[model samples]
Target: MDTVADRVKHLRKQLKLTQTTLGQCAGGISKQAVSQWERGITEPQWEALNALQRACGVNPYWLLHGTAPMLESEHTPSADATPVGPSPPGHPGTCPLAELLDDLSRRLAAADPAVRDEVTRLVLRYLENPPAGARIAKAIELLLGEDENLPPA
Candidate 1:
């Protein structure tokens, strides 16, 4: 009997998110709340589910029923759907944020579990209360650092 709890767990793993991180993405929910849901002790309320959908792009119906596909179909958008706007005037390299995120994601995917957990903690802390100016730059540098002992690529 596959339940919502099972689906939640599966989706979290598929996205490589820790329970706490998943909670944070889902409108500042608590790790315990995610734990309980995964344990089938309780379920997410409607608002939380909506937040989860926005955070992870999961299909809400799929999350609930385990029936439809986990993601919305690409071809299903209405003809009147808003077209993508142009990039900012000074924006460089076309979608810099997306490129950086993709790089970080690939690095994280290749990281060992313990290192991944530590990196995840650092990221969550930064997200929770991001620093200003140069601090943000430094934080990103540190987050992307490799262990000093590793040989140069």
Candidate 2:
């Protein structure tokens, strides 16, 4: 428990995942790959690191350099915190778009970790230059086609 292997093992346990499950969560890495990492026999590739970040909300800086908290803090207000100043014009819960993004994040968080990771990447790409609201609605409709395999309306 002296190197990155230790940290990886620690995080995996924190998430209550077995080696095989951790591998699956980390971008479909092989179980052998996770074993090797835990044994310090080999290091994780960049993709694995990125996958870990998305799947576990790990702080990449901490994962790589061990400089900060393991999980990235979004400064989410705690239940006991009281508001001081006026809320921002487009703060989450106020703006429809922010609410949509928040809902998407919450829903994705409940998905299979590998799928969540993939969707996170897609959402980040969409955020780079977001389209018109109608375009986003269409995109989401296409993404969430009917379970009955019905075509988009």
Candidate 3:
């Protein structure tokens, strides 16, 4: 997972935004301060983080941890269903996140650009749903905990 600093840097590059421009989007946050945040010399305050999220049109959580794809075009999953509670009882799935990611990878690996978009929409739909109940929830939580390098929320 990319840290917040890494994500911020990536976002700036992709958007062709200078520190000055990013600070402007962040509501008067100074260019020097933005540079510091990007360089990992300092962290942004919660308000500043939110401002950056709004400016970049990204989920604050995802921006911090790089858990999800950077663009809507990169998501994948099934249509008409977010991630439900879990796979059926006999289904050997461990983590829904893992399964979803694997499925997306397989589909994307096989798909042409023309048909890949619908897959992206499906992933976005499932990204919003948290796991249900302790059985799956605990496993997912512990799995996430293993990601200690993920940027702090």
Predicted structure with the largest TM-score when compared to the true one: 1
**Where does candidate 1 stray beyond 4 Å?**
73-153
Q: Which tens-of-lDDT digit does each residue in 102-137 have in candidate 1? A: 445567676778766766565444333333323543
Candidate 3 lowest-lDDT run of ten: 141-150
- Give the TM-score (vs. native) of candidate 2: 0.47
lDDT tens digits by residue: candidate 3, 1-153: 357788878877888999999888766789999899898888555445446655565444466556666743455544643343344345653444434344345545556564455545443433434433334434433333322333444
Tell me the lDDT of model 1 at 32: 99
Model 3 CA deviation exceeding 4 Å by range: 71-153
Best by lDDT: 1
Clashing pairs in 2: none
lDDT of 2 by residue, 1-153 (tens): 458788888878888999999898778999999999888898675456667766777754455546547775544545653322222233533232233444455555556676666655555444333344345444543454332322333
Model 2 residue 23 CA deviation in Å: 0.6
> Ranking by TM-score, best first?
1, 2, 3
lDDT accuracy of residue 118 in candidate 2: 61
